[model samples]
Target: MFDEGVIKFSCEWQKTEPLAFSGLETLMGWRDRIFAAGLIGLYPNGIGYGNISLKLTDSSFIISGTQTGHLLHTEPQHYTLVDRWDIDRNSLHCTGPIKASSESLTHAAVYTLDSTIQAIVHGHSAALWQQYLNVLPTTRASVPYGTPAMAYEMGRLFQEEGLAQKRCLVMAGHEDGLLAFGETLEQAATTLLALKQL
Candidate 1:
């Protein structure tokens, strides 16, 4: 109970101006659809689940802020920029009106794995997780979410489990957790949407 939305890393957060909404139109639009689909939403415990992110550079990205899943809609202020992260140290540095999402490090791991991966969508769905668990490149259940172990597990998936080609994997230890990523936000979101049909 109450396992989601807690930041597991040492985050250096700076309160700054809200991010401009210009380049986020596509991300936000897909987020709206994902939330409406009940993929990213509030749990009964009031903890928000799921997060969306886009690569801004090789080392920087914009992600929906932590605990923002309760919102039916989000604004620029609800997002943050993760400018730096050290997965081995389990540390992150970000700037925005809000802190980065709890899954920032995991997203950071994905970006670090490949230069072409430009977007990542982390969401929850019992059916999808159950149906695809182990059938897809999956993390071991021993690794918890938002930690260096989990981040490394992502690397394992890519190096050993063909995750880059699969483009999605189940977080076996993280209940109902699934991540989809691609070269574009559209591909990332569509990958998750496609899983709903299987």
Candidate 2:
């Protein structure tokens, strides 16, 4: 299996200063909550296990930096802007103090589904994944995470599985991986939280 937290796409990163916290306030707040719940954290193997993103524009977004999940709290530098991406090319461009999360392309896939979708929260929960696999809009177990194939699965779900209304899905190929998204950060965060009760 592909290791968690590994970037599968060709990333073109321009290291720069951290972003201002003005637009990231809400995103960071929910991040802290999910981290506290153990949905986002470092595995015993030292690899991180989750990421979140906020759409900045039609083609850009602010995503949690790779490997930052171990931190109890993250600063502005822990996030990076995905300036551009090409799903078919399996490439991404980003800028900030740190590189974008490995899951950036998957988030990019979701954002492209609707301009109204503003936030995406990707977390790890074995219970949730096990309980919801195939029940929720789930990507194929043969399709790995953080790659163009996985990204395309999002499109399949939207077109055929009613993912637009469900707003959350399971990644069967990526152990414990779940994605929740909505027009606002709160909605996305709340949707993720509600999954625990299912």
Candidate 3:
């Protein structure tokens, strides 16, 4: 359930049709790859983190569902798929076993910033995030993830600073939070992967 300053989306999409994306298979493949690399799973104490997404339309995308936890490394059936997440008003608008990624709004803002961005890969790595500050554009140190403020920051990065060209940023306030985006799943995934090689 995502909160908009106007209204929450928890109950608005109660009864929804299944929305599918042509890139579902590829997105899942990338999710698994990131999971295998320990980029989209849990921490040492067991708190889960990270998510992945693929654009479906100008306003919609497919994302890994919420509370995914370690299930990300398990079977494909255990991996929940979220479709038709609307960023304009903040809602899933689709019926699924799991909820949309808590960071759906952030992803939506990226698509809104550039229709050319077809994929987004988000992960947590304190070491990598810290190292990439000089290599990437980053958000302010007070913005929280999954909120409208973060979305607006993303827009500011693109509109004012032209972050769309780089398509990556570190959520300074959201611990270890790092995000990469591109014209395809591989491009976004590779951005995060590039940090590993660094």
Candidate 4:
């Protein structure tokens, strides 16, 4: 879950920055909704995966750190910030020493491919994953994560499911997990919740 301090900090950061009001409000609103929905967890089968992030600028974005959970309770400054592949440093940056989530690259890819997408949420949900596995052809066995290959596979599925308007995908090999993106964080969160209810 998100810390109160973090939520407050995020609110302040958005107010001080040149970001859009709707996007920031959506991000903050989802932070609360995801936590209240009990979507973040630590147990093996628990829904402990996923992060929400917002674009700070065209070439840069801010995302929750690895395993940080959907609800960020800490200060916003504590969250990780990532940028396009450096023409020089060759690595992304984070607020602390911790590495960003492996799926960070996936988030980056979504933003790169869809300029309208302002928020991205990725999580492991038993219900959604089960649906994907039950529906996917048996010939496909494994699903990749945090890799370009996985992104491509998901992109194909998105097309197949007529989900381009929805912008969400479930990974059959990854199990009980899915990724959702939207023009705002609220939309992404709402889509994820809707899938879980189904």
Candidate 5:
């Protein structure tokens, strides 16, 4: 049986200042909508953990910032735009008042795998996650979130499970973690919600 005592990956992250500036107004708008829907909001237990991202260009994407203690309440100034990346090296370049989400590298890996993806939604919902666990492509449970290994695991999914065509993933390692991406913000967000209906 699997044991939580046997944690497999590190949680440490490497953060840096962005070398380029990218606006986040649109990203924020989508975030507000998602937050209001509770897709990335605080629970009755006073806990919240989730993120969203928007592809900026060929080499960058903007992701929601860290410790969003209250996803729905965080201002646009708190969002982060990753202007550059070196996922293989677990390095990132971005600018904003707050740092990138811990899953920034994982998001970067997705973008690196498919240039066509323009938006991403990372939500946490246990019921939807378990209900569709077998229906969607998933990462191994041994790989933890926000680390280089987790990032590579995401890239591996794209290669082995037709993720380029799927544009979504259920992270087996991270409890309740689900990911969806598409050519536009609406598409990605829709995909995420569609998972729950499945």
Candidate 6:
């Protein structure tokens, strides 16, 4: 069940005008289109797909909505804020209206683990997911999604597999999904798009 109030709040936040970055906006737009196209192509059979999320300076993050499909056709504000946990504001108790993607915690975790990471992207692709699952036994237990436990597991995996230095991993339970993060949105989006080719 989607909460209307949260949606409205998130929409408002996204609508708030900001200083323009024509060059960055142009690049991000191109990245979004490329990433979206790659996702669509990878999921041609259409089992699942992925989207991008970005962390701005004010602690608010821009995340694509749940089940929005790829990223190309979606409106800009369709990307909403997953609240920043403001410790001074009784963060845990302060639940605002807009509901971010169910995997918002994953995005949050990446930023929390590394302040340098400005963007994160998660997606579902058949080959990549299959390869990840096939290699899971060689790694530790499978990586899950949509839960705090999974986020913790991912953190552990990052440290153990030396993926902390890298910016991506495959979420086994999500069925064809991969996670990628980077110092900038373009880097993350580019990595995600390239992973499909590798």
- Top lDDT hit: 1
Candidate 4 regions with alpha-carbon error over 4 angstroms: 1-29, 44-48, 70-72, 86-91, 95-98, 132-141, 158-161
Q: Could you tell me how far off, in angstroms, the CA of residue 35 lies in candidate 4 after the best superposition?
A: 2.9
What TM-score, computed on C-alpha atoms, does each candidate reach?
Answer: 0.98, 0.97, 0.82, 0.69, 0.82, 0.69
lDDT per model vs. reference = 0.93, 0.91, 0.71, 0.56, 0.73, 0.56
Judge candidate 3 against the unseen true structure and give its global Cα lDDT, from 0 to 1. 0.71
Which regions of candidate 2 fall more than 4 Å away from where they truly are? Answer: none
Q: RMSD for all candidates, in order, please.
A: 0.9, 1.0, 4.3, 7.6, 4.4, 6.1
lDDT of 2 by residue, 87-163 (tens): 99999999999989999999999999888999999999988889999999999999999999999999999999999
Task: Identify the superior model by lDDT, candidate 1 or candidate 5.
Answer: 1
Clashing pairs in 3: none
Off by over 4 Å in 3: 1-20, 72-92
lDDT of 6: 0.56
lDDT of 4 by residue, 106-197 (tens): 66666766678888877665755677554532112364565455545545555565555757776665555567788877788888778667
RMSD of 5: 4.4
- Tens digit of per-residue lDDT, candidate 1, span 152-172: 999899999999999999999
- Sliding window of 10 residues with minimal summed lDDT for model 5: 1-10
Which structure is stronger by TM-score: 1 or 5? 1
Off by over 4 Å in 1: none
Ranking by lDDT: 1, 2, 5, 3, 4, 6
The total number of steric clashes, by the backbone 3 Å criterion, in model 6 comes to 2
For residue 168, give model 6's deviation from the true position in Å: 1.2
lDDT of 6 by residue, 1-198 (tens): 122112111122223332233233643474467555565322444323465677775465766665455445655444555555532221221122323565666666667777788888776667766766534321233544555555566667677776666567776556566777788777887776776676
